[model samples]
Each structure stands twice: as C-alpha cells, then as structure tokens.
Target chain A: MEIITSNQNSRVKLWTSLQTAKGRQQSGSYLLDGWHLVQEALNQAAPIQAVIATEAQMDEHLADVPQGVPAFQVTDEVARHIAKTNNPQGIFAQTSLPNNSFDSKYVHAGQWLLLDRIQDPGNVGTLVRTADAAGFTGVALSVGSADPFGPKVVRAMQGSQFHLKVIKDVDLATWIDDLEENNYDVYGTTLSDTSVDYKTVVPEKSFALILGNEGQGLDPELLAKTSANLHINFLGKAESLNVAVAGGILMFALN
Target chain B: MEIITSNQNSRVKLWTSLQTAKGRQQSGSYLLDGWHLVQEALNQAAPIQAVIATEAQMDEHLADVPQGVPAFQVTDEVARHIAKTNNPQGIFAQTSLPNNSFDSKYVHAGQWLLLDRIQDPGNVGTLVRTADAAGFTGVALSVGSADPFGPKVVRAMQGSQFHLKVIKDVDLATWIDDLEENNYDVYGTTLSDTSVDYKTVVPEKSFALILGNEGQGLDPELLAKTSANLHINFLGKAESLNVAVAGGILMFALN
Candidate 1:
C-alpha cells in the first residue's frame, strides 16, 4: 500500500478538494468517508478511483476494498484533514460522479422528485434518501438546490445516490412542462386556498412531485404550471412542516 | 434595558449555563434564540424569565417583547456567546421549562406522539414539529431521547414547542400501557413481517404513535407491546426511511 504522511501531498490535496462543489465539478469525483458509504460504493461497483484509510481502519475494513483499486495508507492527521466531521471515520473513497442525465422514456415511466432550490445540505440529502425509499425513478434538482455531492449532503444521503438517479441544474419550469406534456400527473406543493389536501389525492402510477425551497417554498409561477397543487392538512400551530419530512409524506402517500 | 458587555457578568453566566441539559434542569429554564422562538414564547404566555438582544435586534423586534419583561441589551460578542450558531439571531429569551407532567385525562383524550429514545436533536425536533403540524395533542419523550430544549433541537422545532405540550423523560412503556388502557389504538412503528401496512390502518379519533431511535429502531419488546405494529410499504432500494420521515408519514396518515 502506498503511504501518505503529508497534507501537502498532491493526491491528498485533490481528496480534500472534494469537500467543495467547485472542486467536485472540476475533478468529476467526490470523496466518500466512513466504512458504510465506501462499502456501498464498492458493492454498487461505483467507479472508485482510490481508497485512503488510516492504518487502523485499513486493518479492520480492508476486506471491503476491491483488490485492484489503488490503496493509500494515510496517517490520522491526514485522515482528519480530509474529513468534514470532528471525528474522522478514517476510511475514505474517491469515486467518480454519476452521469446526471435521464432518458426521456425512463422519466416518463416512474415517479420523479423535483426539487426547486432547496438549500439545506441535510434537507437535500434526506429528500434524496426519501425519494429512494419511496421508489422514485430519480430526483431532478433545479438551479439553487444544494449540491448533491457536497460532503455534508453525501453524509446525509447515506449512499442513496448510488441506488438511484440524482440529476442537478435542470430548469424546473421547462422540465415540468415536458412532464406534463408526457401526461405525467405533476403535483406542486403549495398552501393556497386553491390547493387541495394531499390525502385527498390518490396515488398515481407515474407522476412528478415538486418541492420548493425551505423557507420560500415553490415559486408562484412553478406552482401555477403543475396539474394541481396540494397541501398537507394539520391541526397544530406550526406554520409548515420541514420540506424533507413533507416530501417524504407526499412521496409515500402519492407514489 | 440592562447592558451586558462582559461574558463574565452573572446574568450572562446564567444564560450561558442554560445551554447544557444539567444547567437547564438546575435553573428550571432554557435559552431561546432567534426572533421567531422568542416571539412564540411571548405569544404563548410562556414564563419569560428574561430577554436578551443586541441593540439592533431590540430596535427591530422590540414590539414583540411583552411589557415589563426584563430585557437586556448585550454587545454582539456577548450575544454570540449566548447564541449557539455562528450567526446569532440577536433576539433571545430565557424561559422557564414547562411542567412536563400531562393530565392523565388529556393523554387519554387526544392524539399523542411518543418518541422512544430518539437521540438526534434534529430528528427529535422535526418529529415534534410534524406532530404539531399534524395537530397531535402532545409529544412524550422517553428517557434517553434528545433534550427537547437543546439548541439544535430548538432551532429545528421552530417554536412549535410553545404551541403544544412536550413532556420529556417519561416512562414510555407505562405511557403506552396507559394509552392502550384508555381504548386508544396505540400503534408502534416496526418492520417485521407481521406488521400491517400503515395505509391499511384507518385514522382513529384518538391514537398514540410511538417512534423509536434513529438507528436501533423500536425495541422488539416495545413493538410486541403495542396494539398493532405498522410499516410503510415501499419499493425502493434504500434499506429504510429516515426515522423523522417515517414518523411524518405515519403521523399524517393516521391523524
């Protein structure tokens, strides 16, 4: 195994760069930390370019690393530098970003989750994980949403990215138009008088559910374009539900 | 308004102590930051021990402060010391903890959410917020759950705690037993083969939903004690839904 002791090492610098969206975009790869996520990447046969681990973690988890993958042993200091959390998990993998494009046929045949500029990394990641749990065909992210590959988001997603498609930077207005044109029952979440209670709508086989920003919610114009807007009816004093929780309820109820 | 510039000031020391579970318990009060939560405390007539704000926040949000409430104007540095986040919302309040013991009659009459040792502050807070949104009567936290008033939890709850009864450190097994004794259809979330799909259970007028920890899920012993165990059916590749998302789905579905 190759050993890396210095934080200034070129490959170490590249691994640390995956912490940012710009770096991930520039390199076309992101870092996955912890045994669970790295193991998921290996199991999914994700394009894992390299594996880096502290000696202790490599000793315990080396069996999960694919035999032909380039392995690097790093000191704890180097591991901590690459990890975003205070407690570094020690095992990390560099994997290529998945292709974000979806075939029109596949988009038309299954449920799709459209996120409109949802910003919280944790919320965005939870939404993707929820989409995976609800059996959505894929998640389409409009501009302004949190980067799906960011470190915090990847941690929250817990490897759901490998299980389904997560397309980013799409123009939601045009995408909604196309889904509607293809006879998909597109539903936007809104709380206007015109919006019906979500439970009142029956689950459809193939539909698109659009959730908006955490605070502002879906844009007024975007809400106007969907087949119908639905709201979750509740009795409490809270003004609204967390977007990800709301998304989960809607997806599970309407899928 | 009392001006507090030194972090060592006695009142400032007291406010800082409220940040921890032990301090919150000993003082019978907790600190709330941000205008929204402080306003909720005022609106709900919660026991507002004191209010602390920067001069600017006091100027902008003073109208919401109740008359005769002891208000302190602190410098930005002192405010940051009291506030948990990097960007402190200058307005804050020190409010007494609520009486956590609910009337047995109240518990028997309305929808109740029982959390079983959920440790994530965000998840616990979101579950409470969702319960509020779903019009549940109150939330009962088991012994090991996150403190409902923790900074992270309070932020995620968005002041919903003021709108509903949140009883913490309760014996959930006994509470569930009491709930079932009163003819409440107590439902426990589990993934066992014998569990029925959540959608199949019709919403009852008064029911208790028990959600478990994020990782371990509901204890098998706890699941075996409920009137019935229910699961959300899904076709996704993800192993399980996030506990908060699962709680939201069940709460909204059965409400």
Candidate 2:
C-alpha cells in the first residue's frame, strides 16, 4: 500500500475520469464512492483497480484493508477533488467495467426489462434494481439509456447491479431479432386505449417487457414491432408514471 | 425589486436558512432552485417572495418575471453561495412556507397517501409527485419524513407540490384518527406475512394508504391499527423497492 498525496497523481486522474460519461467510456472504469458502495463492490468480487482514501478517513474506516489490495491515502483536498462529493466518506474505488456481453444461449425464457433511452440515472438504477427484485431476467440497457455504472445510478440500484446480468450498449432491433429467434415474447408499455391491462398480460416461457423514457413513452419504431402493448390503468389524474416505476410494476405483475 | 448584494442581509439569511430543518421550521419559508421548478412554482401561483439571479442568468432567462414580483441580481459568487446546486440555472425563489394544516371540514373522501417517516428528500419529492399524478386527495407527511419543501424535494417533485394538499407537522395518530373519523379505510404497506397483495386491494370511495420508511419499514404501532396491511408480491430475488417507486406502484394500484 502506498500513499499518493498530490493532485497531479495519475491514479487521481483515473478516478476523476469516471465522473464523466466520456471519461468513463475511455478509461473503462467507473467511480464507486463512499464506504458502503466500495465495500459492496468488493463483496461481489467486482473488478477492483485501486482504492483511494484520505489519511483521516483511512485511519477511521479503512485501517483493515486486505493485505494484497492496492490502497492509497491522499490529501483530503485531493480526495475531495477526485471523488466529486463534499463528503467522500474517505473511500473511493476504481472498478473495471464488466464485459457486458450477453450469452444469447443462456437467455432466460422469462420476463425481461428492456429499457429505451431512460436518461435519468436514478430512474434507470431503480428500474434495474426493481427488475432484479421482480425476478426479471437481466436488464438490457439499450442505446441512449443512462450508464448503470455511473455514480448516481449505482446508488439508486443499491448494489443490485452485482446480482443481475446488466447488459449495456445493445441494438434494440437486433436484440429483438435475437429474442424472436429464441422464441421469446415481447410486451411494450403504452398508454393507448387498445393496450391490454398490464395485469392481464400473462408471463410466458420467454418474454421481454419494453419501457420507454418518462416523457416520450416507448419509441414508436420499437413499439410497432412488439408482440403487444400493455397499459397500467390510472384512475388518478396523472396520465402516466415515472418509467422506472412503471417498469417495476409491470415486471412485478408479469413476473 | 431590491437587489441583495450583501450575503448578511436578512432576506439572504432567511433564504439560506431553508437548508436546515430547524431553519425551515422556525421560519415558514423554503428555497426553490433551477429554472423548471421556479417556473412551475410561478405557474402554480405559489407565493414567491423574492427572486435571486446573477446578471448573466438574469439577462438570459429572467424576461418572464411578473411585473409586481421582487427580483434581485447578485454577483456569480454570491448567487453560487445562495444556490443549492453548483451549476445552478441562476434562478432562486423564496416560497412561503406551505400550510401544514389539513382542513378536516373539507374532508369529502378520496384516495390519500399517508407517508410514514419516509426520510429521504428525493423519495419524499417523488412520492409527492406520484401521489398528485395518481389523483390522491392529499399527501400527509409523517413525523420522520423529509421536508417536502427542501430543494432536493422541490426538484424531484417537478411542480407536483402545487397540485395537491401538502400537510406537514401533524400528529400521525391524530391525523389517522381524523381520517378514520371521516370513514376512510386505512391500509399500511409492510413486509409481514399478514400483509395482503397490494394488487388485490380495491380502491374504495375513501381510503388512506400508508407507506413506511426506506429501511426499517412501517412502525409496528401504526401497522397494528391499519384496516389492512398490504405488500407488493415479489416473484424475483430482490427484496422490497425504493420507497418513492414503491409508493408510486401502490398509489397507482390503489388509485
């Protein structure tokens, strides 16, 4: 274990890079902040590149870092700068992005959450966690969806990312084609009168439930090709729901 | 239309006071940040006492300020000091403290969201917005719940606050007592076996649906008195949901 105290340190730059979408994509790393998330990442046997802690924070919390793991104690100012949070909890970890390639051969013949362009980090994370809890097969993060590995999304998932097969950067059309080949049913969420109640849409052997963004609903192109559209009836004045929450309820219902 | 350049000004101290629970309670005012929220507040005819803007932000966005509303321009540093967010849209408003009193005489019977100690600001805001969209009569904020007017909550609500009756600081027992007096059926969310499937619960004419905290869940004392204890049946491996998301699903179902 070595202590790096300077702002110019290469490791500090690496951790800071994970804060941006571009930086994260380039480095193939995402920043996991605070003690709890870092610990959870460690428990899941997630890929760990390095850990950064402030001297005071290290003394208070990270005194028991395992022998082989690389740990660094940096100046408080440098730690704050790298973590991007006023209170960093004195621990930040750089975790390598998992190979998100899905094994089509192992695709579960059950309910799945297909997210399309859900931009809110919290919403995406909540939906992923709910999908996992509702027993949906791994989440398929389609193009334009917020990065699940991003800091805000990670917190919203509450560590469920480790327990689920979170696939990212997929072509929805191609994914749908693959599912059709594998005999999977597809259901898209919509607010149309013709749509069936989400409750009535019984889960089949293999199925994919598509949820669109909050404001736009499902992409029209994607909606046209789905097996059928499902709607959650609203007796209240609200015309619709937050996409992630809607997705969660549908997954719970269908699952 | 007074420009507040001094951070020590009484109005500035009052605006900044909203950052803490004690300050919010002592003075019946809270802060609203960002353009969307401030705009929504304006549209809702919410009491807007003062507006703080930087010269740059004002020139770009402040054309719509009503004729009578008091507006002020501050340096970027001072604006940043008063703003809750680092990358503020450069607009901040002082909204009068929302009346926390529920008009019992106005109780006519409809769906109501009784939040039990949901302490997270984001969760509180999301629940408020969801409840409003679901067409609930009002949202009853319980004792341990986060301040509904907090900046994070205001941001999350997306202007849903103005659409519903937001009563805070009431005695939960007495509030429930009043609801029961008005013949409202009470239901509380719980993880216990005694809880029934939320989907199965019918939306009666007048009912109170209670939600619990993020971690420990509904208080046993409150759960014991409810007419029914309900739970979202899970077919997956995950346990429970984010409070706000769960509240959304239950509210949608019950509504």
User: TM-score, each model?
Assistant: 0.95, 0.78
Recovery fraction of native interface contacts for candidate 2: 0.59
Error of 2 at B217 (Å): 3.9
Residues B1-255, candidate 1, lDDT per residue (tens digit)?
779899999999999999999989999999889888888888888999999999999999878787899999999999988885678979899999998766544465878899999999999999999999999888999899999998889988999998888999988778877877788988998866578899898965588999998889987788878989999887888888889999999988888
Point to the candidate with the largest TM-score: 1
Best by DockQ: 1
Per-residue alpha-carbon lDDT of model 2 for B1-255, expressed as tens digits? 467688787877777888887887787788888777777778878898877788886887678778778888876666767875567777888888777666654576777888888898888887877887778878888777888887788777777777788887656676667777788888888876567988787866698888888899998888888778898877665666888778877876677
Residue-wise C-alpha lDDT for candidate 2, range A1-255, written one tens digit per residue = 588877788878878888888888898888778877787777778888877888877887665556567888888888889877777777888888778777655664766688888899989999988987787768887889998888899878877777777888887877777787788888887988688888676765689988888788889999888888898776554545667767766776677
Error of 2 at B144 (Å): 4.8
Off by over 4 Å in 2: A54-67, A103-108, B1-100, B103-108, B149-155, B158-163, B181-183, B191-205, B219-221, B233-240
| Model number with the top lDDT | 1
